[model samples]
Target chain A: MTTQTTAQAPARVRLTQLTRGQTARLDSADFKDDSAAHLTAMGLRPSCQLRVCKAGQPCIVHVDGHAGGCRIALSRDLAASLYVLPH
Target chain B: MPPVTLPTNPVSVTVAIRTAALVGNPNVGKSTLFNTLAGLRQKTANFPGTTQEAHLAQVQSPAGPIVLADLPGAYGLSLNTNESRICKGVLTGDQSIKGFPGGKPDAVAIVVDATNVPRNLRLAGEVIALGLPTIVVVTMTDAAARKGIKIDAEKFEAALGCPVVFASGKTGKGVADVLPALARAKVAAGPLSAAHIDEWADAVYAKACTAETRDHDAVTDRLDLAFTHPILGVATFAAIMTGLFWAIFSLATIPMDAIEAGFGWLAGLVSNTLPAGAIRDLLADGVIAGVGGTLVFLPQIVLLFFLIALLEQTGYLARAAFVIDRLLKPFGLPGHAFVPLLSGHACAIPAIMSARAIPDFRQRVATILAIPFMSCSARIPVYVLLTQILFPESTMLQAVAFTGCYVLGAAAGLFTAIIARRTILKGKSPAMALELPRYQWPSLLGATKTAAARGWLFVRKAGTVILAISVILWWLSAYPKPADPDDAQRAAEVSFLGRIGGAVQPVFAPMGADRQLTVGILASFAAREVFVSTMAVQIAGTDDAEGEGVRERLTEATRDDGTKVFTPATSWAMLVFFVLAIQCLPTLVVTAKEAGGWKWAALQAGWMTGVAYVAATIVYGVASAIG
Candidate 1:
């Protein structure tokens, strides 16, 4: 077997850019002082992952493993205010 | 800072405590909880600037006298929707808007459904964030237990740093504890720290929520499959509506007949006992006939309310909204507007008030404007008379045509709503965020009590306003009697009101209504049902010995040119016009009160009258052409 080399990670982008069905690994403190307070109250936190279920108009995001993953509906304006790191 | 000590009173002093505001999401048993706390002392009044009324009551608690205001249920304080904004302003002491005209509450009793803790907690978190003293009253605990959902109240209270009371409004269990807890509580001066809420939400969910081993996915999937299916859902909605209207018509006929018979018998008894003078004529023609005609509709109104209440309680109303939302979108109305529009068919007053459920300003206005277009039950008497005159030989066809009048009215309402929304009431359609409450077997007692209370209120209003108008109409047609029995017909034609109708008759000649019908239409402006009574009085005044009833006299009415006045074309056009017209003064007054001023009501009335004039003109033109 040929030896494999590790690749460098891409730069972090805004949380709102995450596409539908994509999961994000976020830092809880990144959301602490930001507009992410709403997201955190909805069970999205640092070290927690969220899957984007829908990405248009009123975006629907699913929080992983909390109460069988609750669906959070956010207006486009509110969704654009979030920031998250890609997994 | 110094620690101050207060002097003790010589005698025992009891300070009266103020009332608490009950706040919660829609359908979380807040109303039931308010009923428990207030009991029979409850009073409801309309909220300022909005038609939605908040219920208030005084509670005599052991601590002191506390009053409770049942604020309209809302989802979140952050949302800008009308209902949510009202709740937010009340809770946050931001009363710039006049929708809620009271001061902020001393404390809030936050109601939550224990069965749906996750969704309920979201609302609780928002309320707690307001920094007011709050007690979480977890309702539906009994339902939750049956559904295998367990909530640890202690854990929840510890997490939120507030008291949590487990209560069931249905069973009245643990409800007494809420007021006492609220009586002794002090409100926090500032909002909960954002850091604290984050920690609290995470800890509470982690500790209180247990992993579900059973799969509910299948159940939800099947429900979605059926409920959201376009073909089946629309079919089911149509079938249900058809059945409801059919039952309203069929079931109400028995009581209506009984009421009519009772009134006729009373009229006969009074006529035989008293002399044939003004008093006898007033009692028989004015009071009995007028009041009886209005009261005869009570059974139908009550039956309609009963079905609506049952549908609301069983949560089927949401599905209706879901279906109608798609259908009504093109009409420039939201889906939830369906309830208000449907309620308008019974009465525009309640229908206008119900428009508060719509969040967007434009949508609400559109709904309000369209409500008067619905063929309210007030128009039924006029339609029946016109149909009888037009289709005397075909009763079944007339009945069908009467129903078609209702359909035509609804179409006119939808068309107007669309035009208004596109021009004057233009705005983006608000997002649909309605929660689908779980279906339950509707309570028979609850439905009956609601229907009875509403029906009685309608009768009370009729007694006050309609009774006064009927007596006035009778008085107007009674005076200036013919000088002689030989010249009676000529004198009637020369009477002041008869001259008025005759002057107006030329204006309505194109529509084929003679002076008698013209007078009826003019009288209906004061009260819609007066059309029937006005015609009766006019017919009775003209003929001396015929002794024929108003219905028979109307059948023999003819125009000045000796042609039948009640032709199918003219009668149908008149029926259609009444169905489309905004003719009730009381409805206009109520609309003014609900809409915050006379300007909006005037605009609505003027536009609706114009629409009626144009539509009636078209109908008359086409029908005359065809005939």
Candidate 2:
């Protein structure tokens, strides 16, 4: 999933670097234990497109995918763990 | 991914009565649908060994009477959370979990949110792979329509190899189809492997659902901007909390006063009808007064729950949690602790039970330990008496003192949480990852049902214990009656309770409390509000004679040496004491059960009493020095 989207992007940066309203594709996520699996189950898989709604500690993001989009709020620590490629 | 075990007998028709479990993610309208389907036949129950609560209801289906288990919502059946564990256990027929109607449910009803179908589909797939007779109930159809999302149930049903039913719990639409669907439920075709479940869900969702160019919800975005703003959010929370509490206190007064007056009248009737003796006294004071004291708070409890349900239904509660998370993180509490702590202001029994919402055990224990320190409604009568005594001439000072009591209690609770987290329960707070459900108008009927259930639960769970303790205290005080029964003070002096108070008088001597004050303090352990009536009996020989008369007599009452009993220092000490003391027995029992150990309850009681004793002594010393 990551190769399909990241192959087309010129640059990748941490999710925290994305500003409000910026769209990006999730490249990968680094979480301890089952946190990564839990995030994936909530529809934040690699290659899933997301748009930053509120960019800060406890940031809000809209995860858009083929199935439809849902809004989620992530704490600062969680937001810092995700790597995303700007669309 | 964890290995998913598919149940062998998904369509087991061997059981005499069939059972089905309602499974879904949190905020998917599952609860609402359950309540609608099983109206008045449901009861909230705790899953064995865990603090998680689920509702079980029996509904009559076209095929037979089916018992519906409303399992706690989870993100997936394989997650580490208690919700997921319980869901998995029940679905897989884990017989070790007792108290469930059926050891393992015969079927599973997977509720999927229409608006957020993609996110909900993974859980649905997991349930389907269990090979259980399953039906996908697509809820929030009305909300989905408003969002310009359409779900083709035929395509979804065909794609998943199960019947798909669209329902809107809010509008009572498609609810009638649930039972019928459950009757005709069938296990889906070959199970999807654990690794491929997510892929299968996404593919199914794509084929069956279409969205009309979804745009950002402008109203929600604007509301979130103000609600989640740092300074603005805090101010809004404060204002909203103030309004909530103010409404509870003010609106509940009428019903509270009525309950009190009704019981007072009952006590009077008991006294007048019975021949004046131990029976009359027991009926009037021990039974009527004892039970009524606890029942009077029912209005406050009901009102608090009703208001909270409304707030939660509006989806603002998630934003509130997000905002409060910032403040509570430093104290080592997760944002989820907000509701339980807020509920503690009304009563600690329910508040402690509500702590099950905290997923982490250590965090839940910390929250439960800190809850009793909040100034519960039980302490109001004591506060009213003490603040008035402290500021006899000025209402402004009394009001300030009253507010200070709440502030002091809240500060003590928070500080205790901080200290506990740093010392015994040491861990960094877990980062919150919450899905903010879309906002909607709250259901008044649902709020009413919740308030009714909570209010009744309080009475049912705590009522007997309170009555039993009050009766015991009455026996201790009424026994060994003096020769002159007419003299209430002399009888009290000779009774077991009075002698016990004399024995404990020295312990409180440093706080300027005499035998009479000591007796009042000891009696208040039954319930804080009992202090007023106990003082009336101890000092004035009758509790029925209420008002300024009793207050004046108590204020002017003298010790054996003719010194005033209620000294300035003693009033201040007692005020601080009530604010910090763990006086309610039901709260301790609940803490023990909910925290899963007597040691935690002992720790909570010991720590709180120690704090109260030391704080009260210090207050006494300072007041004496100032005077």
Candidate 3:
């Protein structure tokens, strides 16, 4: 169930730009292969809503029950790979 | 994700459940449950030829005693790492698995975190979909209750078409119900399609759980703000690590001394009771010294692992990992490398094994290569001796120099890893994405089990590989029979081992090592601490060594022309040498097993020796200039 905000369609920015406590839906990420598959497997995929738990080099993001109520920590490079769109 | 299929009928169920494999992701209280069920009937075993280990224990159930195999924690069936690969293989009976009583598990139990049902079920659904005779046990009911979460196990079981039991490892709530539930489960005829696994888990959660629509955990929120803060987190991690190392060093001294004294008493008794022959000498020196040398480090290793396990259970480790990611990534390692690197101070063997925590293979290898250079407790005796030889009368100088040795060792290890990443074995650093599990009270039994498992591995290694090496070295020096016991010193000089040492002496002369010091280096291949005892025999004219008074004997001993052998230059060079050298044979053995092969182990030893030699030469050159 992929949802598209027509007005914000081209506004996919990196997750690194997300502010702390701000929730956004992960549209897609530049990552592919194992990196891409890993995010999907961890349930951070298109239309998955995640909140920024902590920001910086190693960032912690919250997928509060929408994906699995888990907090995932991603290195800055990995987080930057994930493109997100604000709600 | 790769989906694995289990055997349609792996075990024949009877009046008693013969075998069951307990599998789950990390932080699911899998070990706690296993410990509660197994009590004291547990033992650790290496999974056959693989470096992976498992805890096997037989627990009495209402039906009968069923042997439970506690597999390593994993996130999914996809084989990204050894831990996950091993779990999938064990559950599916695809590999020739070792350490289990039965060739394959007769039944399987998937532990689902009751508090985090949706996420836990992501794996639970996959396991249930494997068609193995399976039962789902919901744990952390107490923790979930505190969060105002409720799970209806019966409804959850109805949704999954399997048996579900709510159990709390913390309070021993509903633990006895697990075996009976497992006895009733059988491999389903038709497993669910993988495509709808999440939907199935969602459906199960919808039917079986309820919670207040809370935005976040206030406790976790506050803790995270402090623990994940850039400046505060680093300070806290440093403080915690210092406390841990301090505990390991200070607390382990009592047991270390006790072990040393006991081994000394045994050696003395052997010499007193047995006839003075090769047998007596073999038993005393070869068997006792070799095994005893390896075992002496056991207390430090056990304490190191115990503290690590305790910290890991509290969930602070995840935050620490996050905090240290900045430091580790630069060296081509993940943040999780900090624990193993810190633990390397106590001993490198367990630290190498614990490197498995860093999910990436290349990073894990890099961490293993760099670990031995981290000034392990085995190296401390060497550092102290060399530091003393360099600064005999100045205790303050000795302390400062000893601290400098540790700092130098760490810097050298980190740089070595950077070089390793740049040169051979060059590859992309693994992606970093880890779950930060909620902080909880550390499990005491789990910590004990972890310490005991590692401690047992040390003892076993000593029993097999180390014992043989110790005995072999004993024979080499003992034979070529010294013409007279009184001329033992002169006779040893021309003996087989002596010739080997003398042959290598000139090669190492630039670093200022004399023939006797070269022999000490060769002897130390058995263990780093053996350097002291070897020097005592070769130079001090006694077998007793260590901080007690070997400094005087070592500094006073001289060579031809009455030139002082332990000049400040040589002593400084020696300190740098031991700081970088791979002197412990047992460490290489563990490295071989953990790093996947002997080639990596050899590379580690060879590379470290090369580095040690070059660095020691420079130290010698500089010190001689000052002299």
Candidate 4:
């Protein structure tokens, strides 16, 4: 789940599939409009790089690029909604 | 009539003192800045029709006295939330909103966290779109610098078309510059378009903000790793809550005893100084005793709030909430419910108020509904009395039973929450999305100030209601005095409360509660602890005996049929009843206010009483069958 793409583009996986300490780029989120908007407000916008600090029912992530490297914690359902490509 | 016109204000009327509002995303050090600026000259009031509160204070600036309104933090003013509504209302000068000092604030202070500039800018952009005089305060610049991020103040100000100041609320650096910056605050020539605000903010960040590709605090990462671990995090929460309650109990005892003794002395003085009459009794027992009883809980309330504020300031409470979210989500409650649910052990009035922190309306109501079942400290005396009767000789069994009461009560609360969520309060449980702010040293002064404010609020709101109920209860129990006046038992038999108890006795007869026990139960509706004193008064004619003597007398009391009242079955039933009952009047009043309706309170009382009755009846029947 934390595999690196050696010679090809990174394969997109659900955020929950990433292990702790793995870095991934957010692809897109599959949430209702309000939930998706809230996620974006909290700095989880598509194309931002997220480093998983703790991944599980509630995952702790350090987001960079779109956000100013702020840490956010997302519930399991929310994490599952997020599609990320691991680096 | 055609010539009638209003006179213009005199030139001396002075341009009405400008009003400004502070807006920001949560956990952006906005509160610290407000506290630093406003100091002790602030008042907190709820926005009209909502439990959400805003702080307003007068801040003296070179421009003049600027009235500062601190709006609740919101991620987006357009979001469908109480906080966002209030924020937008105040900014738009909604006359319906009561917290704003002026119709519309003359200026806005948009607070952004330097460490999280882009996300903070999202909110800032939303605020700037209002086209009001605005200033962007970049807080925690020190924290950002520590994380290897830099912000060019001039570039940021140029990009946003407003004044920008870098300030650290903790170290007090650049804080002084904020007041002066407010004087030069300017409105944007044009508002940022809502549709392209994201691109605008991102472009601004790309130009004015720089990062050295640094890890966002390795220490914080390690802390989060352990704090958010499923197993370790839960254990940590358990240990912390256990310690919190233990500290509240142990630390509050000294002050509580002092308050009780002081009130007792005052009551004794009043009784000795006054002539024998209803006035003397009222003063000695009704007003003074009522106020004293309510104030005696101040220490616990203060300590609880103080410690919670400290934990919140240190940024640990969010992690705690994250850890507890999964455990509670299944029951239709959110992680934010943890504080209120846990605080219920100390007292339910404050716990109910704390539920304001819960963002979801359904979850907040569900949490409030379940809080009363947490076995508040008021129920401890009843628990002790019943456990003693159930196992008189074995101290160990009594201890086990006492602990079981708490566990059983918690179980009842959680199950009740689940049932309520599934049926009445059904809605989508929003997925948790809490920001884990960087760990910082907690401010003792800030925590103390918060605790003091909340403690006073409790006294002002709950105190008046509790005192009124106490006086009413006292009047009910003391009236219709017999001709002998000194004949306590005869007076009780003729009193309105006693008569009602006698009538209700038949209803409780199946559970083995006689007229005397029924009277105690009726009186305890005012407070759970009143049961012990009512029984002592009804049986022994003195409600002041030490624990052992009182228990001994109650254990041997006989029913009208000469059967023992404190038999195993009866004692067990009483224990179950006390555990599940909603027996606090002050709690109901508070619940009504905090939950925004009396119907919720009515539902709470009705449901809890029904559950207690049915559960107690079952226990009585089962225990008697076994015997």
* Tens digits of per-residue lDDT for model 2, B69-123: 8888898988867788889988898733344565678778899988788778888
Better of 3 and 4 by DockQ: 4
Q: What are the per-residue Cα lDDT tens digits for candidate 1 across B1-627? A: 112111121121123347567888778888878876776677666566665567778787677777677888875566555567777877787643232235677778889776556555666767777767777788887656655566676666655556678776667899888887775453322224544433444455555555443213434334433554567767877787778777777888899999999998998999999997889978987788768867887787788778878888886766566566777888889877887787787767666755766767788888888998898877887887888778778999889989899899899899889889889888667544344566677877667866776687668767877677767766665556676634544544665667778888887777667887787787777567767666665654543222336676777767667777677777877887798888886677666766667887898888887887777778888998898
Best by lDDT: 4
In order of lDDT, best first, we have 4, 2, 3, 1
lDDT of 4 by residue, B525-554 (tens): 978888988888777777674567878988
Q: Judging by DockQ, tell me the better candidate of 1 and 3.
A: 3
How does model 3 score on DockQ? 0.48
| Model 2 error, position B279 (Å) | 2.4
Worst 10 residues of 3 chain B by lDDT: B1-10
Model 3: pairs clashing at backbone N, Cα or C within 3 Å: A65-A69
For candidate 2, report its TM-score: 0.92
Better of 3 and 4 by lDDT: 4
True contacts kept of 1: 0.03
Instruction: For model 1, state the Cα shift of residue B310 in Å.
Output: 1.8
Q: How much is the lDDT of residue B444 in candidate 1?
A: 76
DockQ of each: 0.11, 0.57, 0.48, 0.52
Where model 2 places Cα greater than 4 Å from the true spot, the runs are A1-8, B1-17, B95-99, B146-148, B189-191, B353-357, B391-400, B544-546, B561-563, B621-627
Q: Candidate 1 lDDT (Cα, whole model)?
A: 0.68
As for candidate 2, its interface RMSD to one decimal place is 1.9
